[model samples]
Target: MNAKPLKIGVIGCAGIAERRMLPALVADPDVEVTAIASRDGAKARQFTQRFGGDPVAGYDRLLERSDVDAVYVPLPPLLHAEWIERALRAGKHVLSEKPLAANGKDAAELVALAEDRNLTLLESFMFLTHSQHAYVCEQVVQGVIGELRTLTAEFAFPAKSADDMRYNPDTGGGALTDIGVYPIRTALMYLGSDIEVIGSWLHVDAARQVDVGGAALLGAPDGVTAHLTFGMEHAYRSQYALWGSSGRISVRWAYTPPPTHSAVIRIERQSHVEEVTLPPEDQFANVVRAFIARVRCGVPSGLEGESLLIQADLVDRVRARALIRPAR
Candidate 1:
């Protein structure tokens, strides 16, 4: 017998939800967005009209509904842990936005709660679902890039508006939490979790009381190194390159690519260069499918408790060693 469709309640109406996530969920046949909630009732209503689902006035009320079997939380980082805990206790599976919690301890706690309840709690890192990333990793393991020496990833864009939530420290705002975590997470994917922060630097916007940008150097147990750089106030750049003894591989449009955009991966060895083009893929849709599978079929997506714990711990270590500098 086929499993029932997964009923999802959206807990936040952020831009990501409207632009990418909601559309993806709506297109999937095995999933249903039963409800949507935002701090602003009107915004929730707008989202429902544009997408599908009933608009809920408050997130708590949405959680209390028996119709919702799961929740998609796209709220600010600071509120992730609290809402995740509440949703789990309410018997709903959770898929939350990244930078899982404000700190590692809280993230660990959320993971424990989910495990105890036998519920799926996944961090919404959409890029991980993209086929291009897996292709890159496979090539590295196949020795196409020879012995991996260094991996460098950068994600940055200008956010000068004061109204932007990324500039608000109270909301767990910071370049590292907002965008830097992407490179760090991707680095961990290739370099393994047994990595250490060797050096770090951060630019702080004191008036805003947030880290606007930063760079971190991580050393893997195998002597491979990964360099990560990110900022909310800088020229746009979103890419990562892997350097090996024999050659180098670079991927453009590494993160935040639209569903219609094709990705290009370049490989260079000695004097020969090769470019691999991948077809358009909706990573958000992939994530929704994976979440549904885990909830309904007990399929593992490799995004379990240990992965969240390791990611949170690495983020904490990078933040701890960051030397704060005045924002440019």
Candidate 2:
């Protein structure tokens, strides 16, 4: 609490911003929301009215302010690289929504730029900061799951509105980048980045020319493996599990649990099955605090830069190796 509060501005009032992100930023004592920008003046005004920040009609104007030391970008994936680079060049730290960019190239460039300028660049993988994940890791390490053999994850939801940007290819809309990264990043977390992509597949939405569903297989050196399935055209399933020799540990609502929702772990062994429920946590708020703490440390470049690069590279590799299947 001794460190000065970081003054931050937002680049867009996207739904994720309203529902999960902005609320957390506004509540954090170490973060000051200087402005909230939107292309629509009225929408910007509405967010400002609720969040107590200045209403900015344009994204660029918010970047020019002296009071702003950081920026939070909740824009589409295609726009991430552009604005992130601009914010860094403007001498402002950046926290962008997951995926970082549509490709690894842009992600690498942005990470290097942040390092060169000694700025904080974070990808908002809020779930990773939640206490539930750490607890899960602890359980795994404590031999509750025995010798880890496999990790599997599923993160998907039903179709969006007819006009949702996710159905459009131009916005970097696809199951892989939009939802698949949750499991892929989690895979890297447990399996390590050195894991190789064994096989993959992407089901393309014929009319939209974008991927709607897919799965990938990844293998690690120590006989551990990961199986990931993600989609935008399926029944809602946000969960992952770790299977060891003697038992398995699984989680429900793993990726996007509501703040009031408690963490639940389902464990299965040869003898019995049990459930372990932990306290509720708002991952969105926890991630914002982690970002604030990283900034306060005054480190030139944090682990986030490396995380972004590997995560993006893994995404690229999955796409390159995936077998194309038509949603006919």
Alpha carbon lDDT at 303, candidate 2: 35
Candidate 1 to truth, TM: 0.97
| Model 1 spans with C-alpha error above 4 angstroms | none
Q: Which number leads on lDDT?
A: 1
Task: Give the runs in model 2 whose Cα sits over 4 Å from its true position.
Answer: 298-303
Over all chains combined, what TM-score does candidate 2 have? 0.96
Best by TM-score: 1
TM per prediction: 0.97, 0.96
Cα-based RMSD of candidate 2: 1.7
lDDT against the true structure, per candidate, is: 0.90, 0.89
**Alpha carbon lDDT of residue 59, candidate 2?**
90
Residues 1-328 of candidate 2 have per-residue lDDT tens digits of: 3877889999998999999999999899888999998999999999999997899989999999999999999998778888999999999999999778899998999989998998889989888877777788888899987999999999999988877878789986688989999999889888887989999999999889899999999999998999999998899999999999999999888999999998998999999999989999898888787788778875422238787798899999999999999965
